[model samples]
Target: MRQLWRFGLEQAKSCIFAVVIFSALAITQFIEISFIHRYDFILIICLLTQLLMLTSKLETWDELKVICVFHLIGLALEIYKVHMGSWSYPEEAMSKVFGVPLYSGFMYASVASYLCQAWRRMDVQLMKWPPTWTVAILSAAIYFNFFTHHYIYDFRWIFKAATILLFFQTIVYFKVNQRTYKMPVVLSFALIGFFIWIAENIATFFGAWQYPGQSETWEIVHFSKISSWLLLVIVSFLIVAMLKHIKGKDNGNYV
Candidate 1:
């Protein structure tokens, strides 16, 4: 029970960035400020949060680089998805480009931040990680599918299957207190995706963005979105894992 409590504490610590962002979403939802657009205000809040984390040593420079990469990747997707009418930012914001608020990218960055912080806090390691080439190809395919699905037949289920086949033998090891725990890599992806889905519900309730059905009357986000988050979480995890692998190799402590 003690280890479980410690594990929860570490997870919460790792989620500081996301928590702050969510808090901003909730606060801005009800508050009225004439000088700054809500989206821009949220963006400023995100930037300040990032700076604070960096200055406080809660996030390293290297991890920030990774977060930046995810931010760009996510922003590009947001632009395309909004264009395709997948979802939208209904509010007016000066920082919007092609109808997507710039702050939307930070939503994705928060996921990367959590993964990096949790990896460090829990002393995470991987076992039987797949080859670099295979992982890279899969990651590219998963990302590509996100865009192509709007035009072509969706291959998400196929990619999910591929992910399972590729990582079925792999395990994730994380420490809590004095003991280490192991989980199937695929299961971890599903669990993280589930939690993100819950967060999405909260964000939508707070008016972060609106799905087509949510524009008029807010309802529970479709459960199918969980599969999408699962795939996205897989990509995020693989990128972070590869970075860790490369760093481990450099330090002669390959994970």
Candidate 2:
């Protein structure tokens, strides 16, 4: 019983930031402020939330750096995606740059924050982690595909195959209470991707962003998006793994 309580507590610790961000989004959907754009308000709330986390020691400096990097990465992708007509931000904001709001980057950073917090709180470890270079190459290919698919053939399935080849044997070890739990790394990616897809639906419902099809009315995001999120989860996982130096052997064993 005590162990379960500790497990729940640690899970909450890991999720608190994401919960707060989602809560803020949910609440802001109903709020009307004539003086300020909703996007700018979200940006302010996100920045303040981040500062509060840092000041309270809920997040460490190293994790902050990782989160910041994701923010930039996400912002770059947002700019390109928005330009490519992949998604649309309907609201106006002073914080907008090339039609991408600053707060949009925080959405990506939130993923990093969640992984970092969970890694530390749950004492995660990797087993048979694929070589960094291999994953890096895969990540680059996946990212490039997002942009090139519009002009060229969509080779996402091929990229997904390569990712499976590279990470199929990898395993992740995390703790629940005093006990350690293990899962295939690929499975972890799929699980996180699934949840992120769900969150994307919720976010879209709240008007965080919209697909071309959603310009007139909100609809459930296509289930096919889970594949994209799976690839992204790998990218985020690699970043966190690199930062933590949790490399493992090629065989399904920890070094």
The candidate that wins on TM-score is 1
lDDT per model vs. reference: 0.96, 0.86
Q: How many clashing pairs does model 2 include?
A: 0
**Model 2 C-alpha RMSD to native:** 3.3
Taking the tens digit of each residue's C-alpha lDDT, what string does model 1 give over 1-255?
Answer: 888889999999999999999999999989988999999999999999999999999999999999999999999999999999999999999999999999999999999999999999899999999998899999999999999988899999999999999999999999998689999999999999999999999999999999999999999999999999999999999999999999999999987
Query: Worst lDDT window (10 residues) for model 1?
Result: 172-181
Name the TM-score of candidate 1.
Answer: 0.99
What's the CA error at residue 93 for candidate 1, in Å?
0.9
Model 2, range 1-255, lDDT digits (tens) per residue? 887888778867877767767777788898888888888988888999899999999999989999999999899999999999899898889999999999999998999998999888888888787777887778778877888889999988898788788888888998886699888888888888999999999999988999999998899999999988987888898878876763333445343
- Count backbone clashes in candidate 1: 0
TM-score of each: 0.99, 0.92
Q: Note the clash tally of each candidate.
A: 0, 0
Per-residue lDDT value at 98 in model 1? 95
